[model samples]
Target: MSSVHVEPVIAGAARETWLGGSLKAFREDPLALLCELHRASGDVAKFRLGPKKLYAVFNPDMLKEIMVTKAEAFCKGGTFAEIKRLTGEGLVLSEGELHKKQRRLIQPKLTRSHINRYAEQMVASTLAHLETWGDGQERDLAVDMMKITFDIIARTMFSYDSKHAQDQIARAFDSINHIATRKIRALVKLPLFIPTNENREYIQALRVLDDTVYGLIRQRKAESSLEREDLLSVLMRATDESSQEGMSDEQLRDEIMSMFLAGHETTAHSLTWTYDYILQNPNVEEKLMNEWKHVLNGRRPTVNDYPALTYTQNVIWETLRLRPSGYVTSRTALQDVEIGSLQLIKGDTVMISPYPLHTSERYFDDPLTFRPERFEQDRMKELPQMAYFPFGAGPRSCVGQHFAMLEMVLILASIGQQYRIKRSSTQGALIPEALLTLSPKGGLRATVHRL
Candidate 1:
């Protein structure tokens, strides 16, 4: 009998050489590496991101294989583990039967009809917050954008944010997001020292978030009723499987944590870039403003107002292309797969970088240029379906994509209807921090002038 030697399935096998300067070139501009990899290493390539090494696959067929055909073999990978500390086993991190059951229970409540009914709440909250802004003053839209979305999610999801709750949650969100956007996820296991003020602050802020979310879950249980209109009330009353058991206290806490964390942060970053782009590209801003003015006619926008707001939607979509909040998404390899020439092992990490794909020369013309017209329905046939996935692609895509996009477009239109913005020389265009999300470093400062 011949002895068999099997190759181990891991990062080492995929990368197969000394870490070298290849690792550093990768960390700074993985998207650039992806472009080179496509040309030099074929469609699939191996590289490193700090200590966490990876294989990047850009082929659409291979992408479908991992994200769809054999999704079960690959898990959520390392990032989800970091997020798990915050959201626990909620939808964002849970797998198997638990994930399926949770999705079923939550699906009805987030239906188009349900979300549309509360569209007014979303529009109202957005307008109310924007109204308070003073014209002819400098502001950081990144911070303000999140503040409003936090308020909207509070109203739409929980149905209320007591003055105290709002203050506490926002403060906690600031501390948590600020750190999460800058801190190195690989260092999460390191001991926390008091001298490490940033780490100390991060841990303290998470505690605050836990308390706030837990208290709300308790309150919802005590007060949940069929008559309530808010999402929290609906979630509290939701039943699983046989429709007898409502969410457990632990489950509810995790769900709320997922919402609290994901609700506003990414949307805020996208909106911030949208503002910067609209200001820098005056022609696009003018066209968007014209649409808003014609549609609104000085009246506040509501959910019913969405269809008439086509240009606004286009602007939002285009902004996401240029400054995607989560620039790259990843999946762990499950089965042996060959994408181009590189053969991937079961445990290898594969990157589907939106930045490179969105800006790829083969997929897009002058990928560096900003062009909102690319999304016009008539032009849809020009681009590949999987090429433009800012929210993501396949079953594992962000569930709240519609909700987030709705919030962003409506808020941008409402605010743009009343104000004009210019990039602040003092603040400059923000360079994003490569942490959990693509966050605007410092903040997105712009001069706000009343329209």
Candidate 2:
């Protein structure tokens, strides 16, 4: 376990004296205010986001120390509890051995080999969509990538042969995002959602999502197709190693919704940012193109090409650093803890803002610049550990990080090899829309050109 260099950061603000603070900043625009906080407080700053909610621990070293060292002392917090309104007891909110068991059961579906088998699906779906684009026309790259990725994950995970399956899965994801953001932004946390018409709509959306996902699970079981190699089938058949517990129908709903919620937008944002970076830095795109053209030899790139595809990885890493989709994570202290002289009572929300940490002046030299070469294996080793956490670190770290990275790499190589990306307009600063995941406030726009 790592210990943060105990630097005292104190706040006179009582738990009752809390103003909007970090949560308000999050409500305003999540990224900008967090960067401001990083500048104001050093390693472990004290913040009051929303009334009475004290958010401490905003630095990397302390991030690891708390999330790993004292992780049990901190669970998902009210933010996570709030998420349970929609997600139920899915892996995202579930704690204790149950989480471990659930993660173990689902782990095999996202293994490297299983994901690699899905590479062809990613490539084929991406090309099929790109083929419809006309030359020099502007398009919202964010929406297009969302459509492409949503379709790809379905095929790779559910063998998306029918329009209905794809539509149900995609609708579930969109509906969930809408409900989550609305719930997260509400001023009063608890069951306050019931009386408001705004939250009333979310209830309807959740039901729609539940129905569609449940129907798919049932339909697949009934069909019992011989061609059931997708992640959905894999998950449907998964059982705990010891107790032999399997996902119940409701449990399956939670897991499917969790997968749908977890996968789509984050990967879409990475690719969107990657596309934006390649557009701005023509040299980087050209280098990636050269690598793809040479190694692929006109065939679609595969896992075999990953090692040689260094620059492609560079672009993705740089995007993750600059515009990571996992902008902020919250952990509530379950036990009193002290860091330096600051004494923490339980119930304080520790806000982990990676956007500020990743771009922190102390951490990355010229952190704002778009340079993929910074991720060169040797160069990456120079930084202090946990300073960069697109997927976070520790026991609760994202289980699907490897799957996402592979999906991004495979898609970038296949698509970049076949097309040249041009800047449609640089209208946004990768603005942090920070709802459930960090998203661009304005749509991500770029022009796609053929090789």
Candidate 3:
């Protein structure tokens, strides 16, 4: 620790005040600020948020170190701390031994073989939702994707079929997300116990969500002997080797809530962005539809068909590269360490903004272009490993990555086979907002045309 020297601060730090600096720009649009810093200061940059100093690392090697190689020296920080309020000590928020144990227990359930069984449900839910869309009717495609994904998660993950239950969970998530963004951006924090209107609403929303989740847990426990393949049942049956005990009711709630929030929101936003980009790029859409036509020939997509839909998978990979739903991942240094030439002290916060890295000229050729062909086998292997980590990398990478990708590919194939979506209005450009996940500002407005 003593051998490491203080790293150079990013230029312009001298002109920054306690409240000024990059704070204003960051508050307004963090993505823009990060891009600017990466461009101006090169790979490693440092800035202050009030009294605390933060580091932004854009170098692919450094990112790999922070996320993979020396990952043990870091812990989830920044936004994740805020997320803990909703997910508690679930796999997403847990650390050290608990995270390893929980991850090990849950890993088998999301394996390719296990997730393949959910493919039928994914296609069914997506097709059912598309039935509600009438031709020439303008719809918020973002919200529509959200509903479909939520429905898929409900039916396949928990075997929950009641529309009322789905609606309750969706509304609760919306409320929680709204409050989370506000709290994360606020300069000063307010105690949750405060009787303010926002705080009160947060509590109410939490209560609704808790009631729904806990009720499901109780119901499942009552029927523990049933043979079910749903995620909830699998988790209920998962016994920790050391203790030979399954999770408690509270732990079950936390894990379920974590998966619900993570699985549904990120996938929905990714699909929304994928559609937006496809509509914006006709060639890609044409190629995708051609593949679907060649493969499915107007029939529904299934897990077996995924292998033949090569171009559709490429489009999804491209969308993830351009507009990763989990755009920014952060960590706190647990011990003083050297990341390349830069030295980080214990307690230093490090931010890895994949949004900028994916768009940077250093990694991809014509980084801003919507080119799916870049993901072709030969070309994709040409790039550095960490250059396009939408789901992150290493031990803590998203556990549901396979499940999410399969869902996206299936939904795209099913919907793309049936309709051609076009932007309803050629007005303003779509704005990206950082909420719980990266989502289009307002909603993606488009009209569905039956093919």
Q: Of the candidates shown, which would achieve the greatest lDDT relative to the real structure?
A: 3
TM-score quality measure for candidate 1: 0.87
TM-score of each prediction:
0.87, 0.87, 0.93
Which of candidates 1 and 3 is the stronger one according to lDDT?
A: 3
Clashes of 1: 0
Which prediction has more favorable lDDT, 2 or 3? 3
Return the candidate ranking by TM-score, descending: 3, 2, 1
Which lDDT tens digits does candidate 1 get at residues 96-142?
Answer: 78887777766676777777776777778877777778888888787
lDDT tens digits, residue span 1-451, model 3: 0011111212332334667566656666677778878887898889865555789899888899999999999999665777888899899889999899889878888899999999999999999988989988888888888888988888888988746676677778888887987787776879898899999989998999889889888887788384787878878888888788988988889998998889899999899888777777677777887888899989999999988888888778888877788877788999999899989889899988887788877887777777778777768677778888989998999999999989999999988878888888853556777777787777888988887
**Model 1, which residues run further than 4 Å from truth?**
1-40, 49-53, 162-168, 178-188, 191-196, 224-226, 242-244, 335-343
Clashing pairs in 3: none
Question: Cα RMSDs of all predictions?
Answer: 8.3, 5.5, 6.2
Candidate 2 lDDT, 121-227, residue by residue in tens: 77788888778688766788887778788777667766655344555555555656666776677676546446677566566667777777788788888884635
